[model samples]
Target chain A: MIAKLRQVMLVLAVAGLAVAAYLTYVHYAGVHPACTAGQSCIKVQTSQWSRLAGVPVALIGLLGYAAIMGSLFAPEGEESRLATLGLTLVGFGFSAYLTFRELFSIHAICEWCVSSAVIMTLLLACALARYLLAGGPAPESHSSRYSTGSSGRMSA
Target chain B: MASRTQQKAQARAQRVAEERAQAQRARRQSRLRILAGVVALAATVVAVAVAISAGSASSAPKTTSVAAKHVSATVNRLLGGIPESGNTLGSPHAKVTLTEFGDLKCPICRAFALGPEATLISKDVRAGKVKIVYRSLCTATCGGPQPGAFSTQQAAAMAAGLQGRAWYYIELFYHLQGDENTSYVNPGFLDGLARLVGGLHYGKWLHDRSSPQLAAAVSSDQRSAHALGFSGTPSVLVQGPRGARTIPYLGNYQTYESAIKAVEG
Candidate 1:
């Protein structure tokens, strides 16, 4: 189950990495994002919130997704799981902030940004579930020390 | 023999209990480490987020009015000898015309105004080889159709044109362009820009800015921009006796210079 979960996480991280990489490319290449939503993408990309401090937000996202992927390849242990959780939590928080800025401050929604935010949200959820399942107490017998029953609650 | 068996069983039980205790201790330690790591990471994320938010706040354009006399002097120095009638600047009989579709609130348009447009005006427009036209396209703000303050400000420029000071007003507005999302195009800001235009008559300009004709002119600029299918601001269209061509993007003044030459031939 842990291996399967790791595979799932790897897939998500790769998807996120692709999105972030594309946005970063668009940023540095000085070309309009391939947007179908009538300049909202352009407006959001050009807004001040598009950058953090001096670094482009897209570059930050790219580095973040890359870090998550790196952590996944580390020795399989509780430490690696925790690292993934921590990184995704941060990404989720920042993605939420950017989404808020798009809706409220910029009054424009970039489809690419929304897609990235969705990917981050899913990654955060998967990381959290993986963390919980990994931290469950080891079973002592067939009955198990901890197991989820029909009620969806952990049982001893 | 039975007593010996009991003794060995007791020792085995003790050893098993000790092993379980050690395993539990290791698990507890690992959990603590993970918890500590999470807390530290969360702190760093919060710190970075706060820094980003502070940077964004500071990045908002400064709205405090610049010194009127200083702005007027600069505007005059740059646009002094040019003839501006309505939205057109340079000699009326100039063979070539370069029309710029721009939004006052657009940062990119502001860059063009400060860089290539400035050079084009000083060299070509001043020398009677070109006449530049200021047309409106709300690329960066105001969404669409509703116009809001974007149309109001564009209409204000058209009104300045009525007094033959459109270029002066356009240059000054771009000089003080603010955050696009901010409501900086109020009456005070518009009047402030107008005051910086050396010879603009405040009363007549104010009255004309609210006129229906100016409003239509602003709308007409939008229609023209749509007709040309311009998707962005500072979209330039160069025209001469040969033909008219719209610039695909804002590259540089040389792009405009070349296009003008192409049409001139």
Candidate 2:
């Protein structure tokens, strides 16, 4: 079940990365993100909130999804699981904030941004479930460190 | 009877071992929950902090009274000698025309106008190598008494053009640009801007701004902008002997400077 959860997370992360990459591309390319819903994408993209700390938000999303993908590949252990949880939680929180801004402040919605947010939320759920599930398999690389066997719990 | 007693004793020991293992598992699960909670709390704090920082950074700076006093003089100095016939600036015979599709309320357009644009006007435009044209496009306009504040504000600028001071009015507008969400562009605000344009006739501007010709001019700008597939403000294009080419994004003065050089060549 834990392995299957990771596989789901990987697929979701890849989807998120593609969305972020496309947004980042359009941002730098100075072209509108392909949008069917009127000018919402352009309105959101050109808004004050589209950037954070002078860095484009799309690029930030790209880097974040990339980091989450990196955590998935880390050796399966408490550290790797925690890393995934922490990263996804952060992404989820930030994406939520952006969505709020989109609805209230910017008054426009970019479909790509909403899609990324959904992916982050799912990744968060998968990470949390993986973290709490016990007695699956020992960390492949850190088996000796577990000491409590397949429970992967610290004896202390 | 002795064998029965041994079996009972073994059963009691087995129960005690199972209970101890269960208690250990419960303790481990509790610890995992606490660790996860801490990690989540910390991540939330970080995310909120970053979001707040971004919000504050992007907030518009209040245009101070002190700055307001010098805006007219500053704009006049920047563009005093430049020719401004209608919406165009610089020599009419200049070989290259750099057209900017902009909205006064758009912050990015304001940034480009105040930054690289000043340099371009003083150097290239003054040098008679390039003529800059302003075409109005409403990417950012707030609700006001006028149903179409975009057309009204732009028409006011076009009205200033009647006296050959549209560039001055435009430069001054960018300098005094406020929060896009605020409805600050009204008759009073428009009059204030027109008054700052050195020698513009206020009564003439008032009458001519509502004319059908200027309204048509603003409409034409929107049509051309839409035809170019531009949905954002400050979409720059360079026209020369070769043809028209769009600059993908606004960069520094160097970016526009380079494009002009390429077009001129």
Candidate 1, which CAPRI tier? incorrect
**What lDDT tens digits, residue by residue, belong to model 1 across residues A33-119?**
788986678678766678787588999999999999999999888779888889888898889888988998778899999999999
Instruction: Put down candidate 2 lDDT per residue, A1-156, tens digits, no spaces.
Output: 889999999999999999999999877665557888766787677666777765888999999999999999998887788888888888888888889888976778899899999999999999989887843333443334333442442242
Candidate 2, residues B164-248, lDDT tens digits: the string is 9898888888888755666767787788888777899999999999989988998899899889887777789888886777864
Q: Alpha-carbon error at B257 in model 1, in Å?
A: 9.1
lDDT (0-100) at residue B95 of candidate 2? 90
For lDDT, the strongest prediction is 1
DockQ of 1: 0.22
DockQ of each: 0.22, 0.20
Total clashes for model 1: 0
In model 2 chain B, which range of ten residues has the least summed lDDT? B56-65
